[model samples]
Target chain A: MGVTVLQIFPDSSRSGCLETEKLHKRIMHLDAVQCGMFTVDCDTCYTVTQTGNNRKLHIVHNSETPTTTYAILDTGTKQITLSADYLFDLLLPRLDFMYQSKKNLKIESKGAKYEIGDFVVKIGTVTMSGHYKAILVEVEYLPCHTPALCWSLMREFMQSFMGSCVKPTLPSYLQNRLHDIHTPQDTVQQYVEKFNEIREGTTFAGTQTTGSGS
Target chain B: MAMPVNVPHVGENLEAAMKSQIVPDQEFLLQGSVLDTSLGVVIDRLRGLCDNADILPETFHDHEVVFVLKDFSAMSTPGPASQGVMLRVRRAMDYPDLPYQLRYVGYPELGNYPALLRNCLDIPVSNNVCEFLTELGAKLDHEFIAKGFIMKKGRIKVTVFKMYKMGIGMAKDNLEQMTMSHMVELSVLTTKTDMSVAEDLRALADQLKPLVQLERIDYRRLGP
Candidate 1:
């Protein structure tokens, strides 16, 4: 196994550029990746796994903290663990939205003993790692577009994907929702005011209008 | 034939005898049979047990926990369906001896299943392969559009591994179905992990806590 180092040069200050250039020249002299911890005038360095897929392990930089979170991928186990601070923080918020989606998708129908949605809502099964009492509250069918082409143009890949999918005819409004929090609610009472607010420009996805709530 | 229904007259838990209880041909475990599958009787049967003491809490009284029958579609194998599901219902049922209502919902009917499953075991319509073998073409067609797997040589394959892990494995054996990825996802959503494990235990001692009024206490030292 050979190690290759990719570093970014930060030239925010021209005064340091000359010195940086000299250092850059020195680094370029080493075989693709020169080993031994020697200081390089670079903004960041990335360590990537070289195999069938170059899985990024980590990236380091001069800043006290760096970004682009590292996904802890145990390929053998096929488990993705987000140990990075920013990544973990996003999980709880996603969960809150997921719960709300479950609440909104509760459809009612005829004399059947129970609605099909009931199976999706059954208290949701949570694994013994999260802190909440509920898990998998429900499956939402908000306006969604999953790669689909007419049967004539559908490729084998698309066929495979759709084949595994529970392709139910969902609400048209659901397509635009696949990503938003206010996408769907139990009723329009929850979405009405927000819809009116966005009516002027018909916008969502982080754009706030004149009438905004904290 | 029929499981006993426990109620006020029966003033105690009629613990379900899962032991040596091999139900034959899980054909109509939950489905409305010519022979009525009185689920209400099953729910009534799981009511509170007598310690010669405790009863339901008076103030805010409702079933705190819900029971679910995992990974069932047609019917249970007509006997010890799956220890994984059984062990769980047993653990939760007896957990703290907290009296909670139980319900059973089959898996595939997840459409109706999850809802009916609000928290209990459900019998399935059918599960035996024999029933489908003759209707083999229909099975493939159903699995094709719904499951995206071709049962050639009897091994299922999918474009995505996640679906493969869940749809197929969950039906056969739930134990293998629940992977760590599955757990972390659940933990993120429901926050079911024991809170005590997240951080140091002693650190919590300093916080001013709520006044305690011991409500219902039913602890059974499970094993010797």
Candidate 2:
């Protein structure tokens, strides 16, 4: 019912022995879906944080779920994602704020997207404005949501493949918020940060040349 | 000589002291009104621009029955805090018309602009809604039928409707339409984090200039 996600990167390839027990190696296939995400705001605010009055709203629509709209409100330090069948009710008559964004970022993945015992691995690249931003490797332990409760177990699992990249620290957004209820918005906040970081005109050094899966 | 110590006591005075120091940020509400004389003409113009309109005339038939509840708790207050609460009832469109819809619509608080950031909460409509409101001492003030046309130009939703008062002992066919004007409201609900779309709204308003004056109207200033 819960999940613990770890972002990973590919470094050195293991030759023979490590590849034998790899679940993905035998199947070597996964049903991958291509996704494009765009973050929009009323031209006046940057991140939701700047929209200071009582509520800060952000709209992120993904191409994979073209019909579904995500409206996030950041109130105080708490972020509430509105769940409704009619999300357009909040988006339309764009009167109070004009929704605008520069471009949409695409995420394509490869490498071990299948489950390895209790963990599922996702190796993907995020691209925007025709440039690759960063390679994000996410490993999720399907059973737990609280990182503090299962950090050691997640670290032990990811350490098998990600090796030293498995830093045993939680994302800072979880600080003091570890005990709070976890929702999909926690994952959204992570993507929003990466989307914003790329939107701010920072290239991933020379990594811009890497293709979708490299 | 010992120095005199000034220690503040923690009670009503302390609470008031803390309240005075914390000021909430201002929200803005932008609104405009139009007379019935220009309703047809404005709607006609809106319909002409295909890229600007989705004029599903009947889909805008979002009929609402509004119930106003007074905060008698403020019976002692002579100020605006003594305002009544507004609740609405209607048939839930998504579900079979079995359950009625219930919601609380608060008046817009004073803010920086013509647009208001009012509080609205939706309560599930069930058999208990009536009993619950009754237990809270809510009274049925007046019920009206709001039939209107809603369209969107980009992100802004423009709602134009004429309110009709339910005639006493009236059948479904006997509702009386209020004759003053057709209320036209242009609004877009956004998170408080977004920037004001005043410039875009103003631009759209400019397109309909001279035909009708679309600007912010303070309902309070209009009087009860």
Top lDDT prediction, candidate number: 2
Worst 10 residues of 1 chain B by lDDT: B181-190
DockQ for each of the predicted structures, in order?
Answer: 0.01, 0.01
lDDT values for all models: 0.20, 0.48
Q: Which stretches of candidate 1 lie over 4 Å from their true place?
A: A1-19, A29-69, A72-214, B1-224
lDDT tens digits by residue: candidate 1, B1-224: 12123211110111122223322111111111111133223212212211212342111111121222222333334432222121111111123344222223222212221111111232111112122222111122111111111111111110111111324433422323222210000000111222232122111211211211111111222355
CAPRI quality band, candidate 2: incorrect
Q: What is the lDDT of candidate 1?
A: 0.20
* Residue B110 alpha-carbon offset, candidate 2, angstroms: 4.3
Kindly report which residue stretches of model 2 are placed more than 4 angstroms away from their true locations once superposed: A1-214, B1-38, B49-58, B70-75, B78-84, B90-128
Question: Which candidate tops DockQ?
Answer: 2
Per-residue alpha-carbon lDDT of candidate 2 for residues A1-214, written as tens digits (9 for 90 to 100):
3554635243234232243234333323333232222222111122211223343345444322333334554445555453322223322222132123223433322222445556655544444444544445555566777767776676666555545544566556665557665555455555555455545645334222322121
Q: For every model shown, what is its TM-score relative to the native structure?
A: 0.14, 0.40
List model 2 lDDT by residue over B154-205, tens digit each.
7766667777776667555556778767776666554334536645666666
